[model samples]
Target: MKRLALSALVALGLLAAAPAAWAHTELIGSDPANGASLPQPPTRLTLTFSEPVPAESATVTVTAPDGTAWTVGEVSASGATLAVPVTPGASPAGQYVVSWQVESLDGDFVSGKTTFTLAGAPPAPPAVTTSAAPATSAPPAATSSSVTPTGTAGPVATTSSTAGAVPAEEGGFPVWGWVVGALVVVAAGVALALRLRGRSG
Candidate 1:
């Protein structure tokens, strides 16, 4: 009985010294730190744990606010760090959830969640209606189509002003009246000359 009790005590001491054998892996740190706000989405993710996890047994998923998966490539583990390449989805511009489940070296599984947000651009303001009037308003009449061009026809008032531009000759000052006055002056001079010639002879 004394020998069995001693063996039991030694086993208990071994269990106590190796506490990690019974415990699952725990998260130690991560890139794009938990609860952090980033200006944009990260290209890859790094998750560190207290225990080394198997790369084949590790699973990592990233989700956008719309619940779309953005994880890409295979999950890989190197030492105590698990690395995953993320395919940054379109508009990764809101709250994001990162979930992980990995198997520790001791065959125990541990799971956890982390949250981060990207500075999202504000929703575009509703498009403005540039038109000042409603669509149902009636269009104006097309009077321009009915009007015809008269190239030579002008206003009578303007024509009359153009015709009176030059001075008019009166009937009392005709060219025939000036000709008859010249003939009368020549006849009186001829008769006076004739009378002088007759006296000389």
Candidate 2:
């Protein structure tokens, strides 16, 4: 009976340690490469992970050196790939940070950041084309104003919470939370079973 009790304690100890063994979703690959220099920004940023990720509740933020966000579009997912559209902008020759938070297959949230640099001077904003119309020629600014953007840009989500509720993207405990809970339940069942067996013996 004493030997069985020691074995039960050892089993419980191992069970408690099991949750620590799991790690969060890792970034397997990325387009334009992490910490790389690019002359021109890519149309889309793609991130591939070790496993397929869910599409909903994923966010990517690309902030320029001047404290301006260049992520002009929404995030889309296809298979293991997560793609975000970036608008054309003059990113000065300096380091830029891209941080992202995503959900893994196990319903756990993971986040990471990478930095990349832009070399060479940014090109001057495109010159305004003039037409034969006197009204068009007089107002270069008016011609620029006529060009309406495709869609209404949505507000960017920042890490802030009000009323004591955690944001979905930034909140949530690690995957180990569920793993630890399950292990604790299993340990309790094993302990009960061992106690019953020892009494019968």
Candidate 3:
């Protein structure tokens, strides 16, 4: 009984520490906005996040409606913003999807997709006009600290619990937990029965 009590206390301590290191990187915001219809294709693609991300290892891919690859330049990060330059070209009026695989500071790989639309065909110039909005947002750009390592897992799964908490990937505790709980109940019942018989005798 003492051993089991100690084990339960140790498990509770582990559960308390789970929340701090169990964060996942996610797409907090984007430029041109998802499903937004712009007058023309933007000069670049910008993705913003809630935390500082590694810039050097991020991969941003922009594909036009016509299935042509429109990413011309490299991905750059200055602060919490990450931007990729778009190739100069005319795109038919339709939706374009931006897909990215970025490495976070915790050495995890994060990836997501967002879409934007062009109201009309792209203009001839690749240069940004005075009337043209900035390709990126005001928060400054973000990037990975080092080159993204290959084979990193995709987005992470997070779970919160005051008791036993296991990641969704490895799966929650197996059927054994229920069996052990049942045994504990039976033991308590036997103990109560002995106490009643002693009182009657």
Q: In terms of lDDT, which candidate is strongest? A: 1
Itemize residue pairs with steric clashes in candidate 1: none
* Backbone clash count, each prediction separately: 0, 0, 10
Q: For model 3, what is the error of residue 183's alpha carbon versus the real structure, in angstroms, after optimal superposition?
A: 99
Each model's lDDT comes to 0.83, 0.79, 0.80
Give candidate 1's error at residue 44 in angstroms: 1.9
lDDT of 2: 0.79
Q: Give the TM-score of candidate 2.
A: 0.49
Per-residue lDDT for 14-44 in model 1, tens only?
A: 9887875677789999988999999878889
Segments in model 1 whose C-alpha atoms lie over 4 Å from true places: 1-16, 20-23, 65-68, 88-94, 125-169, 173-201
Q: What global local distance difference test value does model 3 have?
A: 0.80
Q: Which ten residues in a row have the lowest lDDT in candidate 3?
A: 140-149
Candidate 3: residue 193 lDDT (0-100): 100
- Per-residue alpha-carbon lDDT of model 2 for 146-189, expressed as tens digits? 33356847544445357876445447776667889999999999
Pairs of colliding residues, candidate 3: 54-143, 54-144, 54-145, 55-143, 55-144, 56-144, 78-141, 79-141, 81-141, 81-142
Clash pairs of candidate 2?
none
lDDT (10s digit) by residue, model 3, range 123-152 = 588876578676875895785344445686
**Whose TM-score is higher: candidate 2's or candidate 3's?**
3
On TM-score, the leading prediction is 1
